[model samples]
Target: MSQEFESIWDAIEPTVGDALVMKVRFKIMSAIIRECRLWKVSRNIASKRLNIGVLRYDQLLACDIASFNIDELVVLSLKAGLDVRLEVQGA
Candidate 1:
């Protein structure tokens, strides 16, 4: 199994694969963000595609270094890593 799968499974349930989990999380996050009325952004297919892990990390990193999918896996992994910068400062 890929390292991505290791992190992704740990972030979410093993039963729900990374791709599906990413999609579901995106939908939920999108709805929450929409109702917040804070950002004027809408969920795009490209963002979802990025979360799909269609391309290897090396390939993705080579071209667009800013294209990391900050979805559930990344959030959980960062939290696990004790990366306080990723934490909400005040709230």
Candidate 2:
């Protein structure tokens, strides 16, 4: 699913699923950036590790959640030393 959104609320398909995914992606990105800052991790180093531009990584670190897609956030989170996991439970 290509989530190349112009705004955080933007989506490829205006469906509930897309919106939920966007919010989850935003939260995940926020958590990664928060942890990175807490650990004093340099954005430059993270960018190098993620093979992304320093500015782009800086944006990620700045909590610019709306600027990134789901796949990009996942990659950034993994490179930020975070383990990605999914869970399912009765809802």
Candidate 3:
């Protein structure tokens, strides 16, 4: 038998809430990474622009989701000049 999941997080997370949080984090992280790439700057410069350390920037680039929290990712996105928005839907 096999199971199908809507997302990787859904499969790995023990609860729907946990999966939702991870999904949000991944979305924000992806936007930041996209902005960083569009800037065409070196890692050092990118880190400085985001006001985060190089290692942290590396983690973001590497998609290390567990290393970050929602608040931190939101701040990083703002620092990267990306607008963050929230949409709520009833389940």
Candidate 4:
């Protein structure tokens, strides 16, 4: 039951060459997950938390990597109860 991005990351990791860079890519992916949660919740509840124009919000969350920023990603993972870690590829 893995996600599309998770499967994509599994295949992409080995080709990244550098473990550090690969970890960064994972971090970005984690952020994308968070953004998805925010988008979903807002949509479901019709949240007033979002003040931006609908078009802008739509454009922002529409990207595949919408939540690729570290700060937002950390928040998303925390909210989702995901214990994120920085690990070496082979470790």
Q: Which candidate number maximizes TM-score?
A: 3
Q: Rate the local accuracy (lDDT) of all candidates.
A: 0.39, 0.77, 0.96, 0.50
Off by over 4 Å in 1: 1-16, 38-91
Clashes of 4: 0
* lDDT score of residue 46 within candidate 3: 96
Candidate 1, poorest ten consecutive residues by summed lDDT: 79-88
What lDDT, from 0 to 1, does candidate 3 have? 0.96
Give the runs in model 4 whose Cα sits over 4 Å from its true position: 1-42, 45-63, 88-91
Q: Whose lDDT is greatest here?
A: 3
* Cα RMSD for candidates in order: 13.2, 7.1, 1.1, 7.6
List candidate 2 stretches off by more than 4 Å: 1-14, 89-91
- Please, what are the lDDT tens digits per residue for candidate 4 over residues 1-91? 7555445545656664444454564665546445556555664232234333445445435643443455654544555556667655673
Residue-level lDDT of model 1, residues 1-91, one tens digit each, is 6356434435556555655555544444443333323323333432343343434323332433234354543443332232322333583
TM-score of every model versus the real structure: 0.26, 0.67, 0.96, 0.35
| Candidate ordering by TM-score (highest first) | 3, 2, 4, 1
Better of 2 and 3 by TM-score: 3
**Pairs clashing in candidate 3?**
none
